[model samples]
Target: MIKVAGMLLLLDFQLLPPTASSEAAKLDSLFFFLVALCGTVATLIIIFILYFVVKYRRRTPDQLALSGRSYRTLELAWTLIPFAIFLFIFYWGAKLYFNLMTPPEDAIEINMVGRQWMWKVQHPEGQREINTLHVPLGRPVKLAIASQDVIHSFFVPAFRIHLDVVPGRYRTIWFKATETGTFHLFCSQYCGTQHSGMKGDVVVMEPEEYARWLNSGSEGSAASEGQKLFRQLSCNTCHTGDSTARAPFLGGLYGKQVNLQGGDTLLADDNYIRQSIVDPEARIVAGYKPIMPTFKGQVDEEQIMLLISFIRSLKEGREQIPPVSDPAGPQPSPVGDAIRQSETNANAGNQPRTNANSTDQE
Candidate 1:
């Protein structure tokens, strides 16, 4: 537990899949069961009241005075029955609520900020996502949600959980989708006229698929378009090669430990990657000038993911800046590493050849 100016912020990141965990399934079942019970009870009460009214009505010729007296037994039954039912509901609801509120030891933490008509998601891996949310299926996804504007609700109906996102404070909610598929997201609170139009998909996919999606460009799997954008922006110029470039070499960077210039080491995951791209000042890579232009409003989350994908791929090998169409194609090269090595080898070979020529001339 790390101290933060006297306030304790829990760090829970979920790495395990959802099916392997039983808590989410239990809460889902309990929630529907209680809802069903409420509906059934209401139906029965309405039917019973209707039946008594019809059966106990006095006929037109009856001269007896209609007493307005209430029955003690009837009142007691009504009061006790409701009280007991409420207690039952409260206990069951509280049990589920507690489970949802308190995350498991291994639950993954996702920093989620709700802005006007959009969602800004940050992964521990320096991966950033907009509108779309991709989480490994079956893993408990605990979202630390806050609103940039008014109130919003992070809702995934399939998970049967919704969190109220309030400004000036953080609200968290967790859910593990039992099945993998694209789920609907709705802002439960009415924020603006477009509240109904503000929508996105919560894709609960297999872990492999999630990884592929993260790496993949907007156009294909395994490489994101952001990777292409990174090339277009010429980010590879300084980030790769032995050119005495200012920034960290992006090759083999994804999932690798990065030693920041400020002496801070961070895992080059989603959020870190996003911040480094947009706000390079946050965690300076030590040697590189913060000369990186801030992408702030210029780049969206999808583009950021693509850029991250490209960086992630770069970390693995000297592949092409624009990853080739074929996976078997050659990887992009470091801006200057390969060239520098080739130059050294070429110079060494030439020197020996030159000496041989001089011997012949002598």
Candidate 2:
């Protein structure tokens, strides 16, 4: 029991506040106001109870009879005062919640995906990640998240923002990491057997460091070698063109309008596309089945970028030549005649010649 209590207490662990971003400041204000209001009310209630207990206590009296009486003024004051205090708290909390929910108009949008054990993140430039997230300071970052499997929660204690990631639904949560430092993340829900092991870090950096990180040939960069591997897997085969694929095409989809199956329209920008790839059922593409499988473990950030680039390159009238192993000529398929001929040559003279093999054995 003690161990469980300790774990619950550590769930929303918070460290010192970094610099004050807009969201962080608002959150701090809300927290402070709530703590003060509740503290004051609790103290007053305790004092009132103690005072009444002493004042009305029965004293030793041989011929006294006890009678109960109510003070009209005291009752009215207590009732009205507590009601007013609760109302104030409600109004204040609601205002802050509205501010947090309605993201700023100019906020930079990023797609966030949650799975059983990790987070799949995608940047506006098509970069992707598994368990790490990156964003620039002083800029509003919005996350559109969906779960690939069971229900999961996206929580960053430093930011004071959290939301549930449910399958077959789209949920949006935004936060601006004010200070440029690393913060811890938690699932916040009993997800699976590896729930405790499902942990990751959020790296917040300055604009310059973030930019350098993006261009520093790091493995998670949008244009790194992992993207090359992604292209090698040929994701464009079914995602683009009128290729009879079930899901929507990826051409010109980055900032274009998307029509979902349920008569709703959304921008087919970075966030939408990323979620669709990682959690296809979150928002179904119009006129298509949610048959697109999740690529959770098979793909990396760079590969996701390569896939995004390929998709982005498919904008109207832009035919992108896939960067596969080709030497200015047609590339044969793996099962084409060349492979078949090689296999036949390797077994050329190994077959038994009519009855000669039997006679030699005798």
Candidate 3:
């Protein structure tokens, strides 16, 4: 509010939406440039049209009209000038796009699952929030998003980030916050009957505040959950320890070239690993039988993300998802530690943590 003389007046007036992230400001700059350029061109065209209307008007009723003519120089100028302008715009837009899409390697990964009319946000430390995301200010954050049912678009206007959340696959987006505040989150796509209700808030906090906020309600790391699921499904029976003779070793398998059954080697990427789990016969590993059963209906997309995180951590060893300690003292997750000691015990011929009811498969 601003006081003018003895009157109080509202000071909030703008032609653009609020921008809270670095990406938002950059995008706004481009958008503003486009609006200015187009407005200038349109204004000039209108003025010229009015000028010609008056200058070349039929002043006398008996005066003959000018014959239709064309100027090659004018034609070339119009064509080439617009063409050059378009090319420049394309290059600038493309560069901005690639920069936004390519996230820094050090960026922290955050997961989001869209279902019904709410967004389920999961932090790397395993804190889950419904329709709310808490991120540290000035730090790069990557979002791995997926949907449970229909398609939903994750739209954050203040951050200038909008992405589709499809049911069958995972899509990723990134942003680095420049302003610390709460921003609105919405589903731009018409998801369902309650699409309008699919809204959330992004809270950007200071580094110290964010660190303390993370320790509030964590369920444990996602990898720890994945590791527990591995034991529940008896995945460790054939993927590690004593089962390498029958199935391929899973440790350090991610991002590596693995020979297929037909003299072909396939990269164990996220897609390949996902297909291998849901549809085992899609690509069989060399010396391994096509006996692995499909787990499509058994595990959901969120579970698949957890499994992938677990797999990615496998290459870096069990310490990938270590216990997060706070100022109080060292606190360990019950399901944390990535089954290190349990696997060691199993290797020592002690009773393994495999479920007896589970059928063994590669």
Candidate 4:
């Protein structure tokens, strides 16, 4: 009895990490309720076993034991009670999971790439970091996570969030921190030799501080970098806004339903965009020829993410390419340079040459 009392008392202390997100509180509440219910059932079972053992002890050798006994009320009560408890737990857990999976529309977006031993994090506003992530305390933050080498999980014990980052695909997880503080971030999956070292810190700050930090960085925003890549790779040549172009216009493609070749429709989300870039032939849009070359080996994971960011930034009834402050910042590709040179030479050849006689006449 003393041990049981002690165990119940220990429950007062937090068995999990500190709750730092809104969902964490809900998760903890459900967890403790289940724990208490299980504990009560266990205690009663032990007590009944002990009581029967003592009461049924044989005092005389000739004492006869009862063959069987049945209590319909007790049997029904036990069965219905546990069944009801299980149903309640399932409902509570499912509600919490649904809330966790849905993100607010105004949530801040961030990109994360998990590699063998480190995390590469990027903000849509251009700030990039290795392993560390910073966000505002009260705003919802969505992380578009992908794995470069193998499977990795993004886990924060305080937030009670764990999501798998799979290679060749993008997965998103979102959380809003309720307090301003630093929390631990870990890759829960056993990735490789340095999986233990794949750890970082998630710093939740005031809104003002987060803004200042974002402005302090000099790196171009992810969308801008992606814009540069789009031009360098000559994507605009094919996916032009002109209706006669061989490829479909990408303007306002994100979040829209696209008809595929097989008479199926797919939402043009992040994963779909990534797959379209890396695996062009996988799903060809209806009325468009499958002429796009796959970028599987040509571009890395980070480049793919930049392209995705640029694509998502597009809006309906707007130019496909947003105006960049520094349009010529990125150097032209070798092929582009060669084509320009050829054009320049051809124009020079077409110009009338001033021979000696022509110069005298002039």
Candidate 5:
């Protein structure tokens, strides 16, 4: 029992999981507020119901009751009061939702791929985890999650985060840990027969401890692997910076604004790049022809993310972090250099618009 201002409250462990993330405390306050509000309203309603049952009961067999007694002021008060409460809830929930959904600009991005029975996590530093996720304490970590099989929900009660890992697109969620500990990870959606077994642990550790752990078994960097895969898949053949190169140069193209065939312009984000690789024909560059074949069957979700990472490393000013091995870094190309130096106008005649060519496409 806990004693507050003249009141005693019972708190049991069953109320919620351990609050581990920064969002959890705020969410708990909101949850308890809602529960108290509803509980109070219900208690008052029950008291009123009981009082009316006795006071308005039939005392005599021939008793005549009052009819057509309209409480206009009472009606307005009740309706307006509940309306105001709902409005406050909506505003509070919306503000929190907005804050939670928008990941911080500097948050660490981790890629997650969900399958039938397990989760695949890849850190930017190239460490891979099967079902467990390791994050640094007090740092904002954003998860770029996708499903390879069916719909699944990435739920962590301690973190107050629950997001659907849907197929066909990436769903992102961000959380900053407040306490360093292991929390339960679950797929809250009913996916298949072994849905209950789709569980994991989220391990939060000190920043230095996490760095040591990450570097312990580091796979060569994700960008390096992606670069290797890019060559193995013959992507370098067309996406070169040579003067005679057919396709548009890929250097400094990650966050550039691109013009599509229908004059539609959008940032070259992960989804845009993913669509360009998988569909090829969905969104074409304004000045280029669609000749690149679809890589839908050639690459999986993880590979797509790797490719994105590789491309992201090509940002002109930002030197590549978590260095890519083998080639030392992304090589400079005449066309890519020209594209990088020039302005972002489609008709600039110097800016490389599409990663396309006369006969070969990609």
Candidate 6:
């Protein structure tokens, strides 16, 4: 009994690393449960093996071995027991997996861009850091992760979370830190010669300290940078605030369902917004012509994130700045008026002339 107790104590020491997040605790509980179950089954199998070896050992060669007897009840018991245990494991694992994938709606959002050998973390307030993430303890954080070069994985052993960050698309993971400390962060995928060096730290601090740190380094919020990009990219020329503009007004578009040209509706989530920017022709919105140019190569991932932040901020009917016009020439009429007038002329059977000047104005 003493020996067995000592062995069990030593086994406890070999358990998983310290868990720092709520999800990590839950995951570790499931892991330990599986370990105990497997250990029990292995011990029973070993005991049975020893018993059969001794009981069947031949004492005399002439003493013909009793004809082997088969017990249907024993066979069925072994098979059914193992099968039921496997089913239980499957169901428990599936439930934990679903819980890990779903994030709370109120989670604080952060953007992460992984490159050849470094991680770029951007807070919603526009604070940027290299290879380090500062998050508040006891608050849920949702990471919108992407890779710039190749496939990378965001892994934190202490948090028991691992997610793939692929280029040209976004992946997300969330965790609520329960402890206040720094934990190891790693890119578990092999991308290049420097994959071994793709490691960082996640610093969890108190809410007040996190807020101060977020405001210290960055000059402006991400939404502000996005606003500048929106104008510089000439997006404002068509997506005007006026309802009669050629393109749909992007105000209040985030988190809302949008009708597509293919008679399908899609929720305007971050992924959908990203696809619309990089591949505009992929899913055209209903009632809108597929004339918008793609910004795939024109902007990088960080810039795209900034633009998304800006667009998401346009909630509750917030107005956007109008497109800038040249001061050296006569001002052109609003594009909305031109669209309405052209529609009226077409309805009245009049020859609707194309507004070349209006196009030049834009």
Q: Which tens-of-lDDT digit does each residue in 1-362 have in candidate 2?
A: 99877876988644554533566677788788887878897899999999988887768766355687989999999899989978887898789788888886556555666777888876634356678888887777777776778898887877877788887556787877778878777788779998876778888888666755544433322222323444565554555355575446554465677888889999875456666666778898788887778876776433454455334434343233333343232211111111112322332222122211111111
Task: State the lDDT of candidate 3 residue by residue for 274-340, as single tens digits.
Answer: 8888888989988888878788899987787777666654542333222222122222222122222
Tell me the lDDT of model 5 at 329: 41
Computed on alpha carbons, the lDDT of every model, listed in order, comes to 0.61, 0.61, 0.72, 0.76, 0.75, 0.77
Say which prediction, candidate 3 or candidate 5, comes out ahead on lDDT.
5
Using lDDT as the measure, name the better of candidate 2 and candidate 4. Answer: 4
Q: Which stretches of candidate 4 lie over 4 Å from their true place?
A: 1-15, 55-68, 317-362
The per-residue C-alpha lDDT of model 1 at residue 87 equals 90
The C-alpha stretches of model 1 lying farther than 4 A from their native spots are: 1-28, 65-70, 217-362
What lDDT, from 0 to 1, does candidate 3 have?
Answer: 0.72
The numbered model that scores best in lDDT is 6
Residue lDDT tens for model 4, 140-248: 8888899999999999998999999999888888899998899999999999999999999999988777766765643555666777888778787787667787888
What is the alpha-carbon RMSD of candidate 6 to the true structure? 12.2
Give candidate 5's whole-model lDDT.
0.75
Runs of candidate 6 with Cα error greater than 4 angstroms are 1-15, 54-66, 316-318, 325-362
TM-score attained by model 4: 0.81
**Model 6 per-residue lDDT tens digits across residues 1-362:** 99988988987754456689989998888889988988998999999999988998888877777788899999999899889989998998888888778987667788999999999998766678889999988888889999999999999998999998999889999999999889999999998999989999999998777766765655556765676777788888888767777788887687789999989999988899999999999999999899999999999899899888777756434244445562222221111122223322222111122311122111
TM-score of each: 0.52, 0.63, 0.80, 0.81, 0.82, 0.81
After TM-score superposition, the amount by which residue 110's alpha carbon in candidate 2 deviates from its true location, in angstroms, is 3.3
lDDT (Cα, 0-100) at 167 in candidate 5? 92
Tens digit of per-residue lDDT, candidate 5, span 1-362? 23552252343326458999888888888889999999999999999999989999998999888787889999999999999999999988888898889987667778999989898998765678988999988988899998998999999888999999989998999999988999899999989999999999999998778867765756555655676677767776666654455565666777789888888898988888888888989988776778888999899999988887677655442232222333444432111212121321221232133421111110
Weakest 10 consecutive residues, lDDT, candidate 2?
A: 331-340
lDDT of candidate model 2 versus the reference: 0.61
